[model samples]
Target: MPTKPTREQWLRHVLSSATLTDAIKVTATELFLEMRANLHVSVPRALLARRLGRSERQVSRRIQVLKESGFLDVIETGWKGRTAVYVGMFKSRGSDAQRVTVSSTLCEAPKRHPLEKPVPVVAGHRVTPWASRHITIGHLRHGVCRNVSTDADASMLEHVPSLDGHAWRSRTAARLTFSARSAWPLLRDTHARLAAHLHLRLRPVAAHHSTAARKRTTP
Candidate 1:
């Protein structure tokens, strides 16, 4: 008879599967460890949470995902004063039929797209592309032109200031407490100042020297 696969080998198979997220994989590893140490496959959510240093709710969510993905199955549901029992699936197939069915299902699990993966949270907050774009537009609208590194960026500075009266009035009212009449002139002045600043900042020093040389030669 072929040797039975050990618990560690079974765990490696599950972890190598692409269907589970990192959080779920961690949860699975913790559950597997608990089973190996206890010599049983009945890991409780509370115990897994404590071992993984995560909240019980989070552990439950990960367990749910594992169960849905066929990596885990509930042997007994927990009730008042009773802990649930869970068995890791695909550990040992009793027959060829069972092995074939599980292998096929696991292999057919939908692969996640790269773009659909969750972005890493920073400082307990998520910064989305839309939010970043809005921030960039706000900076452009305000007279901050230091980030205008390309012709497209420079054009946006002009395009933003040239919005129609209705849009300009609404946006200004939303961003400031001042009335539209006062805000329009202020916005125009700010834009004019930014344009003049960019003009001076972007003008080549060599062009200035050439202009001076041309003036001296003419005299």
Candidate 2:
């Protein structure tokens, strides 16, 4: 039977990992939690490294660790003029009930995404813990990833066709792609409440290339 998670278990589950089995991942997870608590936007890797007292390379590696471990990851990468913008992944509470206590056994198998069965990967990361690979948390959901699939589009369209992963059509009801499901009812409730409060469930909604273009066509 599955075990209940305590606050520490949950934190550790999102923190310690195989690739980032060191101090960097630990600190990055702390930073992510703090950022989540404070709602910080993408501030750049250098700035984050400075704040964490680590080198930029260290921060970068650990961020990858955080991403693979399902704590934090990237949402979008784009350029405004010659400058690029990357939307940082921070687990924002959706509803009060959406947040649950962590358990003691963190290394235990993570439950499947509440909405999905058991997908090997999602976004760009492998979700299968036994697959001998590591994927980022961003690839799981947005903030809180319960499950992952090789194709987010396939995962999202369990109930209907996903419009051929044509991001534009898939953009609708983005967050709900991994909504509360039978996988973890208790955690789902906690997540729903947590997301409602933090205003971000798994991840934030997908970003549009241009807001004007979004309105010019039907999604």
> Please, what is the TM-score per model?
0.38, 0.27
Runs off by more than 4 Å, candidate 1? 36-40, 91-219
Total backbone collisions, model 2: 40
What is candidate 2's lDDT per residue for 163-190, written digit by digit as tens? 3223422343354345445434544444
* Per-model root-mean-square deviation over C-alphas: 22.0, 35.8
Candidate 2: minimum summed lDDT over ten consecutive residues — where? 95-104
Candidate 2: global Cα-lDDT? Answer: 0.44
* Residue range 28-94, candidate 1, lDDT tens digits: 7787776743224766667777888888877777777667666678777888678777776763332
Q: What is the lDDT of residue 120 in candidate 2?
A: 67
